[model samples]
Target: MNVTITTIYDELRGFLDDHQVSTNETILEQHSKDESYHTPSLPDIVVFPETPEQVSAIVKVADKYNTPIVPFGIGSSLEGHVIPYDKGISIDFSLMNKVLEVREKDFLVKVQPGVTRNQLNKELKKYGLFFTVDPGADATLGGMAATNASGTTSVKYGVMRDQVRNLEVVLPDGEIMHTGNLAQKSSSGYNLNSLIVGSEGTLGCITELTLRVYGIPEHIAAARAAFPTVDDAVEAVVSILQAGIPIARVELVDEHSITQVNRFSETDYKEKPTLFLEFHGNEQGLNHDIEFTKEIVEDHGCKEVHFEEDNAARNKLWEARHNLAYAYMHLNPGKKHMVTDVCVPITELAGAIKFARKRIEELGLLGGILGHVGDGNYHTSLMIDMDDPEEMKRAAQFNEEIVEYALERGGTCTGEHGVGIGKMKYQQREHGKAFSVMEKIKLALDPNEIMNPNKLVHSKRRSL
Candidate 1:
């Protein structure tokens, strides 16, 4: 028997303390969508749980009612991971924000799922340590783990999956379980930690995360190298990685993005395809690496290469890169951003990006290309009027074409973003038989299909 929305709301209100449950339309609408172009679906109710027991109790209540429960953190996901499409309950984790422990000696930090990256970093700074996975936004650590997020530093520090030492999960059935222990390495049975990391909240809700941290590097330097063409800049990245330069971050911002950055940042960067690169190590090591990188970039037809030695200048350089998405938004004031992510082998990156640029031009879309090129991942941010059907259709076609191209080249549809609602159609094509295995796991874990249903896996659309 399906419970009515009013009944569920009343039950939730009865179980929670003041400020724990809300049925206000404005708050419900706020929890309905993420930062994507997907249509928003308002949940009937929103609830915040401050402890693992509370989270488990809420899940149990939803299970009894056979109502959908969507776990949300900061609502910063670029895909539709947090959307409560079935008009059920949205479990916001904001109240659970806490940094429980910081094991400085062991290089690990334990935090509640609601803790944002910036919040954790602030506490880690006193210990001279930092977390590596930065997903552009100051998103929650749990959301980062959910999407297996990777960012500018991924080429060196790896993604969210790599940094996670353990996870405390509240399963769909309200069963509390530990994915793994704090051992540095394990040769145990199945890798549940990894399975839950990128499951997009379909398998379970992460309550606490024990993450690996890094010590502050001895020396750091930032550089900007402008190339005659995007192809040249991509090739330079390939050469740098092939030569084993331990670059902390290597991002590519195309000519269009450079123009947007100039407008948004109030700085005059050359309006050309450029590589924003950073190196971290001892002074001698960084100098040697920079020298080698300069030679490689110049060989690839770099027009201008400048290094920033001052800390303020280096921060300014990365701040510009981090703000590229907002810059695109600023440049196109009235349109929504439709970003596409595809990752290929390093050798094939230049060709893929070149093809994307030509395709964007052919489609007559106003967009810019920029991403962490060192990891063979790139994104094209397009500004589109969401209300215009023709423009939306064209954007969909463009995304499909790019994903198909990447798959044809043995690449992935998404490098950092998981298979949320937007990427669902490509899963079967991307994973084939393995896709069935994923569905089977989903059934085993969430038989009622209550945990973020219609996401990551395809199921018949059901009405609330």
Candidate 2:
């Protein structure tokens, strides 16, 4: 017995506002998919909840109906975490966007789940404070927390989990709970806050987040260093880290990505394996750091190093880096992008990149390699036509081989993107005996398997 939109609407009508529930095909179709390459399954309905109470009520109703509930942010997830694969309700929190409080004195900000990093930064600019975990997209704070996302800045500031101090969650049984306090750190039993930060909405819906903020640095400088080989760039990053240079951002872009960036951003940068880097500190400190970094990079065979001091030029440089994925999409119009993320130990990063590059070339795929090198994590963005089964197969094979390589080298299959549908097969391989423990936790939190069902875990559907 398949659950229908009419059934859900009838059950939720009394508890929600008239306009909050949507059954329109256009809206449902729009919410059905994310930025990933996974196949989409249209949800029976979409609902926008504005408050924790309302979200709890919605969860209760869905639980009663045994309908899967997926928490949706901006749908910027690269792992298909936001896609409604089993056909349920996509609870969109866009309307709940609100920055409730900014405690400058304590260096923390409390915000509603729908608040995005860009949006929060706009507000924090007045206080000379900023949040640093940027995942390329202006993704919602809730989504970032769901995926434990990190990007270029994560090399210095850490990922979403690092910034999140507390979470107000609505559990599957409609119970509201606070995961942590506003304190800086704690020895408290069981770090539930850490557990829920990357739960991917299978455990609960995040209604509010208490995030740590940072004061804007007095000095900032951006630099681009081109290398003769990708291995040289990776080795340079490792040397920089080992030398204890406080790099604010260290991103690796292979020759393929530089080519796409050149075509898309209309900038004539050398098409070579490069590291787009940045540093933030006092002027004197940054100067010394940059000088030391330059020396280390030169020793590693750096071909050219260009530094940008002006704010506008620096922003433009990063803008090009952020647009690399979009550029690949534009270059391969009418095709889907398949990105595989894997992280290895710093010493092994160069070897891993070399192997992946050889494999990608052997498979004959149009893709580029890029990532936050400071963290020893990288992603290969493959442009594949969904209509071509052969292309999809080759992409999957490439992803599997790279993940296997990483796992064998004591690394994770995914560094930032959560295990949605794309990386589910590797969970067992990566977690080993611990994977069973994860399933037990899932069963305990969501016995009915109604919260984002068939995601992050493999389980059989209970008969109604």
| lDDT per residue as tens, model 2, 223-275 | 99999998899889988988998898999999988999999999999999999
Candidate 2 residues lying further than 4 Å off, grouped into runs, are 1-5, 462-464
True-vs-predicted CA distance for residue 141, candidate 1, Å: 0.5
| Alpha-carbon lDDT, every model | 0.90, 0.91
Q: How well does candidate 2 score on lDDT at residue 23?
A: 86
lDDT of 1 by residue, 1-464 (tens): 14577787777777798799988889999999999988999987899999999999889888888888889998888779899887788999998899999999999999999999999999999999989888889999989999999998999999999999999999999999999988899999899999999999998899999999999898999999999998899888888988999999999999998999999999799999999999989999999999999999999999799999789999999999999889989878889998888898888888888888888899888898987898889999999998889988888888998899999999999999877888888988999999999999999999988899888996554622
User: Clash totals for all models, in order?
Assistant: 0, 0
Task: Give the Cα-based TM-score of candidate 2 against the true structure.
Answer: 0.98
Q: Give the TM-score of candidate 1.
A: 0.98
Candidate 1, residue 215: Cα displacement in angstroms equals 0.2
